[model samples]
Target: MAITCGLVVANIYYNQPLLAEIGRTFRLSESEVSLVATITQVGYTLGLLFVVPLGDKRERKSLILVLILAAALCMAGAASAPSFVILAAASLCIGIFSAVPQLLMPMAASLASDEERGRVVGKVMSGLLIGILLSRTISGYVGAHFGWRTMFWAGAAVMVLLTGILAQMLPRNQPNFQGSYGGLLKSLVTLTRDLPVLRRSALVGTCMFAGFSAFWTTLVFFLESDTYRYGSDVAGLFGLIGATGAFAASFAGKSADRKGPDFGINLGILLFVGAYVLLAFGGYYLVGLVVSVVILDVGQQMTHISNQARIFSLLPEARSRLNTVYMTAAFLGASLGSLSGAWAWTHFHWPGVCGVGLAFGGMAYLLNRFYGRTASVIAPAL
Candidate 1:
């Protein structure tokens, strides 16, 4: 399931390293090409709001397979797109269907015992994070050697293969919610209203992801600029360095299991701030960039894993809905970050991008530090 999660989630990120090539192909600017990444996250937010809730109302394995197949079709569209508009449209569709990992996470949570849930989620999340980081490496090399469109075709083929393998390997999970889809979505609001931690966690998640997205969305442009005079292939190698965060995801899960999740969350947010500080001051040097990306990615996975560990423990029956609320907010932040990162790069360059990351990280720190200070919200039994 973890491997499958990584493969499907990777489709959304494959375009990041290829943004420069795509812009060259379409004769567009950095800000204009950024719409591809932004719209993709917008589609993902929509899927998190609408599609992920269905996980509770539908058979889990079948839902994952269907979404994977849909993602494969969308990737094919992306590959064949002749114009920028068509490519953006296909990217939107790809984001919408690429909500497969959200479904898979809840399935893994449901199957595991409470005692081991954090470890289990960490293991699966390691794969997802690896997929996200490695997708850049793979796509960067593929886009440089072949054309950018070849990466999309490769993504499609991988999804098709994942669908076939998961069908035979995954266990069939019965639906927990018997109500209509409309009712299921409505309960998301109810869940938000009732769970204070979910709301706070969602907010923190939003800021953290916004910072994370801002860095990644603008990185290739920075690399391609006169300062580095590098190509996409070299830019992609950073993902390999960032893969150290995958280990952080696992370690964070264990930390949350031993210490409280609050400890992990705060530590993660601090790492986020420190990473931006390094990037702001040291980003001109390749070693500084390398070190900052490692810090950034590790912080991202730590916060993400810790947040999921806390949220999944909230309500056994509403894991999907809880994830829906949280992930929807997170992806929405990502969309905003991508848009802002592009605009900042156009207006103020690398320092501006670093400023954006700092602002978001600081906001997240404030929220995490102050929330539940007076009183603690209790998590329900699994």
Candidate 2:
């Protein structure tokens, strides 16, 4: 499950360093290459809207398998795109189908004891975090040697194998409701009505990820600029630093399962704040780059797994729909991050990107404060 999710989620980020390579191949500008991120986020947001709810209504195993197959097809299309337009369209498809792992995650969660679920999830999520960070490195090496298209091909092959593994290993899932699909859409609106549960989970998850999205969106710009003077390969290696956080995920997971999310979140905040401090230094000193990645990634992944662990406890039966809302908010932050990161890169450089991340962190902190006062959060029943 970890390998499957890690490889699939990696698709979202693999193009970070390759943006420069893509610019040269397509005779595009820096801003244009940045659109690749925008397009994918937009598509993923749509996927969160339409596909994630399937876990609540449809059978999860089949839904996951179908989505994986579709993702494979999308990767193949991305690999074979004849032009940037086609490539962008293909990326959209990849984003749309990448919701597969989201489906699989809660399915895995449901099977485990609550006491151990966070640990199990954290271990699996470590794979995902590593995958997200490493894909950039892998793509850099692969794109430099074989061309950017080769990364998509590699992604496609991974999806093919994951599909088979999932099909064989996952439990059979029966439908949850035979109701109209329209009702599913209707419930989405209800979920957004700021129920105490959604308030605590969706809002917190979204706000936290906003900072995460902000930092990651312009990471390539940071590396490629005069600040770092890094090529794709070096930018990619920066991804390895993030793997440190991945190694720590199971620890965070065990902590979450034992102590609950509050402790994990506080730790996450301190770590993220430290990450920005490190990056602020990185803006001046080149060596700070390495430390920043490890700190930031560890913080982000810890908060993420912890947040999901808390939210899932609220609505066990509706895990998929809950994830849909959580992730939708998460992607909204990402979309804002991508667009803002591009504008910041065009205008204020590394400080601007850091500023974006810090602002989101501030917003998340405010919300966290509000959450602290709420009856739900004061003594969260979960």
Provide the TM-score for each candidate, comma-separated.
Answer: 0.98, 0.93
Candidate 1: where is the Cα deviation over 4 Å?
Answer: 372-382
Instruction: For candidate 1, write residues 201-291 as lDDT tens digits.
Output: 9999999999999999999999999999888898788888999999998899888888978888999999989999999999999899999
Clashes of 2: 0
| Candidate maximizing lDDT | 1
Residues 1-382 of candidate 2 have per-residue lDDT tens digits of 7887888888888877788888888999877888887788778888988988877788878888898899899989988988999999998988998876687678778888978988988878888888888888898888878888898899899989988888889788665645677887777666556356566656666766767776766777777777667778777777776788897788888999889887787688778878887787665675687778788888877778887787777667767777788888888778787888778878888788788778776676667656645554233221
The stretch of ten residues in a row with the least summed lDDT in candidate 2 is 373-382
Give the distance in Å from residue 130's predicted Cα in candidate 2 to where it truly belongs.
1.6
Q: Please report, in order, the local distance difference test score of every candidate based on alpha carbons.
A: 0.92, 0.79
**How many Å off is the CA of 228 in candidate 2?**
2.8
